[model samples]
Target: MSSSTVKTIQDTLKAWKSLVFPTFKVNDLLYFFLKAGLAVSTFALVSLFFYLSLSHPSFNSSSGYDYKTFKHLVQQRTIADASAGAEPTNVSHILFGIGGSAQTWNTRRHYTELWWKPNVTRGYVWLESEPPEKENWPETSLPYKVSANTSSFKYTCWYGSRSAIRIARIVKESFELGLDNVRWFVMGDDDTVFFTDNLVTVLAKYDHNQMYYIGGNSESVEQNVIHSYTMAYGGGGFAISYPLAAELVKILDGCIDRYSHFYGSDQRIQGCISEIGVQVTEEPGFHQVDIRGSPYGLLAGHPVAPLVSLHHLDYVEPIFPNMTREDSVKKLVITYKTDPGRILQQSYCYDLRRNWSVSVSWGYSVQLYPSLMTAKKLETAFRTFQTWRTWSNDPFTFNTRPMSENPCERPLVFFLDRVESVDGGETRGSYVRYVDVSQKECDREEYVPALAVQYVNVSASHFLSDLWKKAPRRQCCEVINGGDGVDSAVYVKIRSCQASESLTPP
Candidate 1:
């Protein structure tokens, strides 16, 4: 080989040896591994953080997330956790604000006292001014608080009373108190009689941590239309969830002036809530009672829900005949205490042997019809009352069946006389025949058999409050014993409907 070629090959071999067999000290190797370990750990940590930010609802808002969206997500998570883990809502969690006037509070206080349990129910009666004899305030009545002056706010509703402005601020004032553990702010007129057990049952169905505006609109379409169908009639009472009330109080006073053209306090509240993008969650149990006549038909065929509140009591006739309004209310309240879950719960069944159709309002009354009636017709309320404004027969919020003028066609009516708890959480409600001496008696032979039946004994198992959480269905009824009209009374049993059973007539 040439001498130049040999020298080039020798240099290449030396370079390859240096590249393939490079040497390193022990400390250098240790330093290299430490750097590699730190890089791996950093990569793992970054991956873990990203995973948590994307997957976890309770993530930190500062970690590159839209703050409002993050806040909403966190609130949703918190509400879900609260609804699942928190204690059940009770009367102690509800703060009531009853709008009253010193001039009329004395007479109206009776209605409030009926349901208000001193020290048990938390709330105040917000008055226009200090009531007469404030130092002598009855222990049974709700503690009174004079509402903050609302005279500065404009109320342009020509037909509506200015008292609405003061009443609208009661909610804001109630929230400002900052009471602890209050889940609901209930607003009502002093005359509204709340069935608190039923009220709690209804409220328990919802999560108070979330925004909720729960109530019923006026029974009269005209009333609803004049105000707003979306508004919860304040007289009937409406519940504002704590979260919603917090938001409402912030903007309510400003909203009152903005919605000055609104007719009622409820409308103004609804107007404010609407700006917040929440809607009224109408619960049929809240009764505005915007009717001019008898509430019998309405009560007897109550919608299949708990009776939350009843308003306009003084405007209508006593629920029972031949009784003072106070006494009538007392009677109903007594029955309500016996079976709050079952009060006004309607159930009807047929005695095929005697061709009798019996409709029982568990804690109220019963009707015995000699002829067969469809379940739809039986469930539909009788038009014994008229609209509040026009005092007309038509245009009610619910469907009503007209009362038959013919005595023979009408069913024999009965009213609840007594209710008692029996063995194993069962309730026996006895209803006595109600005879209207002024009206003509049904002389038909078929009706005579029903007339002989003077008493209806209805037995029902205690209705569990949790049943409200389920899809609503009316309880089923069966005639226990009405043997060939020989017995002076009929017995009936009301129970949860079997899966296969239905209210279809034979």
Candidate 2:
């Protein structure tokens, strides 16, 4: 036709190409749909992961990989405020594995209320047989029995005692029951008394979703060698995290059956857990008090680590210098009930329930409460006191002359009494160095001649006696390693000396 007609056709073609050109090439409609689909899939997957994280209180391996986010999530999971009427951060239960026959409940039942009830509210007593609930059911209403059968373990406990054999099953059954709400399952013997609050605090530090076998080793070198150090000593008790507990419940029976060569429950359980590549996370709180000497020094001076449990309370001697076995048990239990934290934090200082005053600022000093005993007189009184007292390890301390000056400059008492007097004859450094409770590394202090007392300052028998009546807010110690040599001793000044609180023994 004409040039105008050709121009009109070209314009129409350009307009058509602008609208539909891309649609004709490379399946543009399909590509657009595919991009939309990929975006929706990515968003859905992210949402699913977030939803899973919210649903699970603890973390999994994938969640653990997100370091910062996972840490924040963990903080939220375990922050418990009992001050706000909330329970402990780690919701835990104690499966008190007692291997008693029908009669063991007679005396053992009493300890349940005194020790276990206050701390482990969610504890259960696992007995070989059900306790008699009626006329002669001892004196307790604790209904913690789970199972009594010897065949509870899939394997026959070839070398195990009745107690040793059933441990596997006891743990399994307890985990099954506690699977829902309990974040941790703590296994303890009936005599095991736990500082449950500390236990909760300790568990809060770890992620519940990760497997943890946490406990203390035995004090016995022989026992530790015979059994692997990886094993948790049974008396002190141990804790398994929720995720680990779930995993163990699934395969522990099988593992136990395989490890029939093991003699004890602790060894058997350790073997099974080790298969899952979990190492024993040692926490010092679970004490298997195998040491025979008084745990007074240990209990009074726990070095600020959380005091979780003390085993064999009945078996140990009196913690105080002079007290009946029965009275000592009562006293310790009472002290723990009063303030477990204070006991651990102030593990360094203790009382004799008598008339002398001693304190440690950075260094230890002695002050005779009735009179300011000179170094000679102080030694005489302490020596005379030692004659009657069963414990004589800690001796009175004095500066070069006497405690005639203010006792505060050198608080007059120390938990670690001097093993030897600095000088039998009075001189410049006439003093004694006791086992310093503050020095955790050494058995005894290096040396001393008394220093300026700063932190602790108490005076008079009556005042000192009543000082700890109301629990102190925290443990107070000079935190000095006392000695003559610089590296050897913690240099502390004496503030004051005080006597024990005069509370009547219940």
Candidate 3:
């Protein structure tokens, strides 16, 4: 009785234990499934939130709801009910800060010619050195107003080092003088000159009302620099719109004591802007080409067809030693001198434009070709153009059908009649040869005596007269060409030559 009873009791106890505790395997499986479901739900919720915020107009940043005050303003003005005809005020202004060494001062003149002259009305110039003791200074005969303001620091060790202090003073004074109309602040070295004629017009087209900052397209700033979440590269030529500028000033004013120890002005500015949670607009065409060891191209973006500006920081004196008051007053225009031979062979043109009115001699020439080639002659030309045309480097390129694409065949004639022959000695038999990229081979022949031809060949595919017609007329050298290849392709060539003796009327 005891043995049988003991076995039954033991089996009963085991069964009871199994029912109460359950299997370890089952518990583990259940726990895993529960956690997986929770994780999936959490992820889905987060994704849904982001998606809703991104796609729906109510949640979009462009919608006023993204910011509290912006929303209130829009509501109060009944902007939501307004028609499309309502135009918002464009609140962008160009602010330029000028200071530094004699070279820096000279650079300012070029900036004046390129940027200030064409675009902006107000700017600040901080004199690094006392203006040749007022008594010894030359009489003020320039067209633009030149004011000499003293700096707290007598001598700045380097341009970058002193930029912050100079900028601080200029910014503060600009704000105090009720000059709040400025929406963008452009800070750069003095020697910068714009190569392009249409930079201001282009910028005006794109300056939207936002906290944006544009910089020169250079790797140096991108890699080595830490920009504010909202701003970057205060040097070279950089622009910060009004709202950003105002916000930056507020942050700087509040945190000046904390960031005072930072040596780099750009770093300090970036740090402060980032701390405030602003976003930076990495734009092309703002640069500090004057910086030592910088790239040959514009730092901010692609090159423009016309130059915006160039930093003449290095050769400021020798280049403009004889610059006169009259030169400053005269309206300067750039005329491109092209060698057609270079255009056909290299699919590029060696072109140079110089302002005869100014004594400034240091200028850059460009070689431009089609955009399709790997050699990137057009890219180089555009970059060079932007470097001088805009305060920064930016190339404005648009795609269109090339002259070679046309079905009709016509002879491309490059007329040299408008060119004033620099070579006085007249030799009759000399002729110039040019390669025609529009044709498969350079077999086509067109001849004009050396005396009659000023420099190079024009592709039959292109008409110099057409280019001249579209170009700004003043005084220019006309190149004329006609041919079957002219239907689909366009070409530019570069040539080495002395300055032209005469410029044709447009």
Best by TM-score: 1
* Deviating ranges (above 4 Å) for candidate 1: 1-84
Task: Tell me each candidate's TM-score.
Answer: 0.84, 0.55, 0.44
Task: Supply the TM-score for candidate 3.
Answer: 0.44
Better of 1 and 3 by lDDT: 1
On lDDT, the candidate that comes out on top is 1
The lDDT of each candidate is 0.87, 0.50, 0.37
The residue ranges of model 3 lying beyond 4 angstroms of the native Cα positions read 1-93, 101-120, 128-130, 133-163, 194-199, 206-208, 217-232, 290-307, 312-506
How far does residue 303 in candidate 3 sit from its true spot (Å)?
Answer: 3.1
Tally clashes: model 2: 38
TM-score of candidate 2 versus the correct structure, residues matched by position: 0.55
lDDT of 1 by residue, 153-204 (tens): 9999888899999999998888666566778899999999999999999999
- Candidates ranked by lDDT: 1, 2, 3
- Among residues 3 or more apart in sequence or in different chains, the pairs in candidate 1 whose N, CA or C atoms overlap within 3 Å are none
**Residue 100 deviation, candidate 1, in Å?**
0.5
What's the best-to-worst order under TM-score?
Answer: 1, 2, 3
Candidate 2, residues 1-506: lDDT per residue as tens digits? 79898667666655665687733433444456579999999999898677646544233554233555455534433431111234535434334444344556566655555665534366567776656654554434355564746664554556556557676566777754432355667887766666766676677666665678899887555557666778887778888875676567667667877887777888877888888889999876688765544554345324335578877767666644446755555555564444343333321232223222332211123231322323232222121111012333332121112222333333334332221112332111112333335433211221122333222322111112133334333223232343332232233322222454222222
